[model samples]
Target chain A: MLEQGKIDSRQAILLIISLVLPTAILTVPAITVKHAAQDAWISIIVATMAGLLIARLVTDLSLRFPGKTLFEYAEEILGRVPGKVVGFLYIWWFLHANALIMDEYASFLCSAHMPDTPVIVFFILGIAVAACAVRNGLEVLSRFNQLFLPLFLGLLLVVFILATKDMKVTRLLPVFDKGAIAILKGAATPASWLGEIVIFTMIIPFLNKPKEAYRVAALATLFTSFYLLVSILVAIMIFGPNVTGHWIFPTYNAVRVVSIANFLERMESIAVAVWMFGGFAKVGVFYYAAVLGSAQWLGLKDYRPLVAPVGVILVALAALCENIVELLDFLATAWPPYALSVFEVGMPLVLLIVALARGKGGEGT
Target chain B: MKKIAVLLLILLLTGLTGGCWSRRELTEVAIVLGTGVDWMEDGRIRLTVQIARPGAFTAGSEAGARGREPASWVVSAEGRTIQEAERYLAMKVPREIYWGHCIILVLGEEMARKGTGMITNFFQRDRQPRENIWVMVTRGEAKDFLETYSSLEKTSAQAAGFLERMKTGYSVQLWKLAEMLASKGIQPAVTAVEVKEAGITPEPDREKKSPPQKQVGLAGVAVFKEDKLIGWLDPYETRGLLWLKGEAMKGVIIVPSPGEPDKAVSIRIRRGSTKILPEYDGEYLRFMVRIRVEGDMVEQQSREDLAKPEKIKTLESEMADELKKRATAALEKAQNEYGVDIFGFGDAFHRKYKKEWRDLKDRWDEEFSRAEVNIAVEAQIREIGLLTKRAGVPEE
Candidate 1:
């Protein structure tokens, strides 16, 4: 084994949640609303179901090869060169997805907090902290996330609750205005977002109780969808569906709209702080998986040496976004099926079907 | 080794503490309190901003020391666009401009009449302006309202914000404006401000003549037809609009007594709600505006009320009649004259008649103008004051 770490089932669920939710809140509502309009909430629900379906498939594949990662089992299922190619593609996927997450983090901080700060400044600062946590091994990163999720969720709930003052039921009227096809078209963006839950394939090997992955995945999916659902719903109710589509970060704008007796106002900092916590966790998870997966592919004695060089590469990739507009343009148009769903769901399905036909592993757990 | 490591950590922390280029100190920024926009005659935007001077705030708590130099400074600049005007305004000010605490966005009468489409788009598209800031249209120039003095609060912007919170007229914030404008079958109507003379409290002395000062006060609301100011509604018409929109609160309605000609009774509107019952009968559409009001009989000049239920009934009927008249006048103005659906009756009709709305949405203004609206007000006297009759009259 390249690493020795054991995280409980609950911690596993929280880790998966930390992996998906933070960036989902940043841009999903606006992108979904662009296609779905007033029916964006319906699109989000459909996307959640699709996401859970993919999570189930990916979790099933991980269970078929218990106590072993996809990298290890791919070699067993297929021949050496093909398995290595699949493993190498996943490493690239993790790095690419992690870089996008970093890009989202910097874009949000710049617009919501400080607009003039250089993108490289945020890239360096964000990667430095995330890299530190990744080098601490999986258990340390998971435990650190355990301490952060509750605070992040608590602050998030507080903002939404205070934001209820502005909610108008009339804004959500004329339900299903855009019809089913538009709703589905809107669902594509967040559906691809939810598919990121396939990161569990990389983490199942480290779970103390690997058999609980299915139940944990289901629960985490439910928990995460509730947040995403309420986030878009409140944003629509407060800003109206058409207006909600105009904001860059509707969730943060929703938080900024809260005014309780005028004394409790302008709490964008709380939203910013919550996202910062999620950013660090999400970046750490992908960074750790990418580094560890590369070490496994190369048969290295230690994975720590690759962390520094990989962090440098991530900084370079994150800087690829010229500005927030270009970043959102990519997220909205091109990245859905190609950059995200391919490795997260496509190859995993093929690998699972191929293994099922050949009947590889799972004889003696 | 521990001491050496601690020193190294401190050195690194020192080098990394000051944030990136966006970092700033408090004294280096000018806090914007109010923003006013005007349309110049030569097709340009005139931007006026009320910036708070923190140094003048410390002289508060003493009676005579305040208002000597004023607590806020007003400045204006002009350009082809709002952003250009703002850049010019920025060039004139030494400190960095911060809009985190902006209290209001005021549009001048000409600007509102010309169009508020660009202003609405510009404000929401910006990252700094708040969603809760009050949006109002002034009778003359917005710059005057921004510069007008406020006696109750330190600044006119704060005073106008407080006025909106009190629901003086039809209160609309930036978010509400955006929602109304963005949603179909509805239009935006915002509160109004006008510079009026607020006479000094004490009587003017013969020797020392004090100059009359101007104060920004709420003056009903400016009604819009798709972001262009078509007309203005006075306080009573605004109250009627409020009642039609289910927001009537903290207002008073005076009704004539049943039999008496100049004698009347006063009813304080505790709360009210309006329901739009859209009826589509295949050939024609009719809207029944069902308004229910509950009020307190705070003062009465009629002498026929000595603990009598009949009097309350009659008073309720008369109050209902008054409400109907006011709402009918507003309906007449909106439907017949201005021909705009600021009351969101179109939304109710759309919610109920979604199929008909598909064809009617393009020509909703005409449909609204032609549609028959029936106003029915159900007014109830919830409570009477302690006295059943006149306060100081002896039992006769």
Candidate 2:
């Protein structure tokens, strides 16, 4: 057991929010716009709702095992072999998700700020920072989120305010131009980000108030959805659907135009600040979850010793994708509603149904 | 002992990853302030760059001591692709080229006429080019335009950027042009830069005599048919287009006084707003453009005391008529001559009638040419600057 430090409801909310918001806010606008066009904001709302539903499902399952994570409780619900298989799947998902996040952070920094720097540098440095936070345990990571999320949000709002000068309200018009089917198609990618809240299963055992976990997760999803909506709206209004759909990072591009008498310009540096720290807190949460969950599955007495090895593997996995275009293709077409939904929503849902059918209850624990 | 070991390990790691890998010092990089693209007669694209010499910016420096070479070095190279041309130019330059600071992109008339879509790919593909860099079309070779220098600004690029900031016409940034070209509902319009010998002859002065100077100024607006430049709109017509697009921040409109036949009153526009309403009569479509303009009378060459309530009202009506004439000329040219919807009327239609816009979107330019447009101008004279009546003319 890694120092049984407990976090309150607010920290849970911050942790989940930090985990899901950073990469989605930076990349979802372009992906959603590709399918939904002017109605991308509608897709975001639909995805947020789907995400909240998934969160509710995961919270319900975690509540069934008050003090046990998904790894511990899966075997209790299923037999040993099948349960280990499920545990391995969850471990693989967390590792994959962390690697993907690391890849995104590294590529965005490489392309946007320092083009000449090898992307491996970012992967190594990012994992190093994340490993340090993960070694400090869950409480430290939660405090990191609690401290930096507000600054991230504040700088985001400043960018939003400065971007209003170029925004055209009519750019968002012609709602439902591509019809309901297209909007739902656009919702898939963001829905994956929201469903990743299922990672909370590992953290719920450490929550001071596990009963309030569902409400906290819902609120976190709501806040993330609201920020996603604002980002997509600002991008669409400033750059329009045609540009936002094509540009790799439309929100950063919108912030790049925040030139007010030259003194208030280059606000992209502030955006970089948000991306760096928010991305750090984000990867740290996943890193903690992956390491802790793996240690628990392997029946280790402590999870801290597993952090560095797993962090190294994650850094290596991040380097597996050679270029940004390949990563983006995976994100747009392969990840959503497929690999992501299967682990993030499907597996947990299957566990819930089997547990209910088998008459397994948490009161005896 | 454990803490000391951990501290030492951290120090070793820091030394290993102290600085950003692939970092280039400022002295080793040449900053490109502006870029110009022209179509060569040999069927290749010529890329011209205005490289800012940082040393010249220092006072009394070798390059700036006698203004031997302004603050920029202009160079051009020709190749099939813009990147290829840039790579060719890179060989002749001494330092690595940095494009993040480039603020302006000038397209030559021939290159723009041939279609700017081909040359703009590198700019969009590379992350270095800022989306908000000023995009303009020059009347002649873009290389020649980049060579024109003025005494006001340190370099020609700075002068060009300052001239654009004056709001002579609508300023189209690279990304906005991209957006316009990509979207079917709207077309692109860029400011046109013209380099000519200074019209005013130099007077004898104590300073060392300088040769006749070449000045660069914004000529008008370059209207595009899809991605290709089709024609130009005169200054008044450009104002009309800006007014319709709600970008006419400040400009002057000279109208002959209603009471005095020969005397002209110049009204300095202070504020303006435009609203385009698409009216569908269930059978045919008609567009109504309502323009509201507020200005102050800057010059009244007549002795008529135009600040009087009745006189101001008459002037306002006359100004309104003049505005309508200008807007109608712009509308007619767009509708009849070029047959392009540069005023974004198609977007207005899209916002108003979403379902119907889908049907007409494909052939919007054709429909726009035959569509009925109604122009209504509401001009208000809010203030008469400094004087209530005429200044030099005898007040009768």
**Alpha-carbon interface RMSD for all candidates, in angstroms:** 1.5, 1.3
Mark the regions of model 1 whose C-alpha exceeds 4 Å error after superposition. Answer: A339-341, A363-365, B2-8, B11-16, B19-21, B59-67, B203-209, B259-261, B281-283
lDDT of 2 by residue, A55-157 (tens): 8888899888888899988998887889999999888888899899988888898888887778888888889988988898888888888999989988898
**Native contact fraction, candidates in order:** 0.81, 0.93
> What tens-digit string does per-residue lDDT give for candidate 1 at A58-127?
8888888887788888888887999999999989888888889999988887776777878788889888
TM-score of chain A of each: 0.97, 0.98
Q: Considering every candidate listed, which one attains the maximal DockQ?
A: 2
CAPRI-style docking class of model 1 based on DockQ: medium
Worst 10 residues of 1 chain A by lDDT: A356-365
Question: For candidate 2, what is the DockQ-based docking class?
Answer: medium
C-alpha TM-scores of all predictions? 0.96, 0.96
